[model samples]
Target: MADNATSNRKRCSLNAFISHAANTTDVVPEFPARNGPQRLVAAATKQPKRRQKVILEPGHSALDWARLKSSGKDLRGVPQLGRYTLTEIKEHRTENDAWTALNGKVYNMTSYVKFHPGGVKDVMRIAGRDGTKLFMLTHSWVNFEFMLDACLVGFLVPE
Candidate 1:
């Protein structure tokens, strides 16, 4: 009976030590944003637009394929996970939430609307933020004219 009491106390002490260690190391901490009081207050007050989900089907659309050879049009060079129209983007603006980091920085390359060599559809497969890296890596013929056009459009967008 005396040994049992000693064993219970030892067990409780061991449990306490384990709980303390686990709380310190097992948790990853998140940092709060550091901003000036005015900025923080403004940010707190600002109401973000309630976004809705935008769904793009897994495969390329008929419109996407058609735009491939439509030459002499400007298809902003953007990342292509799937094809989406500007109208569709507005309707389902929430999809932009999934791509916040890529937004403003990336453009969708709609080869169908623009003139492209190696076929516009082929380029559409790789239309994200890393256009220069992708272009140089994939050996796609560089078109400064199209790139410049895309840059002009990208610059005009409000951040």
Candidate 2:
């Protein structure tokens, strides 16, 4: 349902193939290198060996989470979005009803438990607490705002 101009990917070929000819001819990159072509391969030594992620269950992938978020489901456990105090958020620390404050915004993380790559227990470590510091210390590169936008309950309020 997206326009060709707005789409990030280019549609060059009507036929999909795996041969070298198909890749070299059909796959036309949007940005061509100024200094001829560059190799797509990367050095093995440059690749990272490990990360904090664990194997996610079927249908719990990051892409699955993105789809679920766009499904119009109310992931937030609360009846409506409202400023929540620490005590109020603390009451929702259970696995079935978890909440956390990050960067002053409160997000209902109950729906995100299975989608969390760090495992359920790791996410529960900050349940009912402000996890900005811990989240920064662990995975600062993650954009929580965009990831958990659909699960946004409200803003964190002073207790």
Candidate 3:
């Protein structure tokens, strides 16, 4: 009878130890509340952060472009003249070199670089650039004053 009691006590102790170890070491609870709201704040109250415009460098590598091309994605859309791939734009420089825009426009800002509102240096970095597969020139010229905005106007120049 004593032997039986001792064996039963040992079994109960082993089971208790296993349960305690599981509760202590386990990271996730066995069951979590299913119907709780995922997000606490209302969506409308959150203001989305605006994307900063990229100040392009001449001969800058188009990492995003290369990735898309490697993935077998279609490289459609208009060109961005001042914007270019690092490899493609590296060939052009000096007075005669130029980069083409999406709508077939051309901007030779090398000489006019100084005249840029953002200063000539910024324009030169992106001018004579190439390999830009996508650009925005769809808006009406009257909607945004060209002369007032140099970045916008640089792409607006006709070929």
User: Over 4 Å off in model 3, which ranges?
Assistant: 1-90, 94-102, 131-159
* Tens digit of per-residue lDDT, candidate 1, span 3-106: 99999999999999999987775645344435657667877796966744334443445455444424445444343334433333333222221111122233
RMSD of each: 16.5, 18.2, 17.2
Steric clashes per prediction: 9, 0, 6
Which candidate comes out best when scored by lDDT? 2
Ranking 1 against 2 by lDDT, winner: 2
Q: Write the per-residue lDDT of candidate 3 for residues 1-159, one digit (tens) a residue.
A: 999999999999999999999789667643323433433334336687674455544433345423433554322222342534434434555444534333433334333333333343444555545423322322234222222222221333322
Q: What are the per-residue Cα lDDT tens digits for candidate 2 across 1-159?
A: 578654534433423334456567565655545443442433223676586658789999889999999999889867888999998889889889889999999999999998898888888998988989999998899999999998899999898
Backbone clashes counted, model 1: 9
Who wins the TM-score comparison? 2
Where model 1 places Cα greater than 4 Å from the true spot, the runs are 1-108, 111-114, 139-141, 145-151, 155-159
Task: Return the TM-score for candidate 3, rounded to 2 decimals.
Answer: 0.25
Scored against the true structure, residue 4 in model 2 reaches a CA lDDT of 67
Local distance difference test values of all predictions, in order: 0.43, 0.84, 0.42
Q: Give the candidate order by descending lDDT.
A: 2, 1, 3
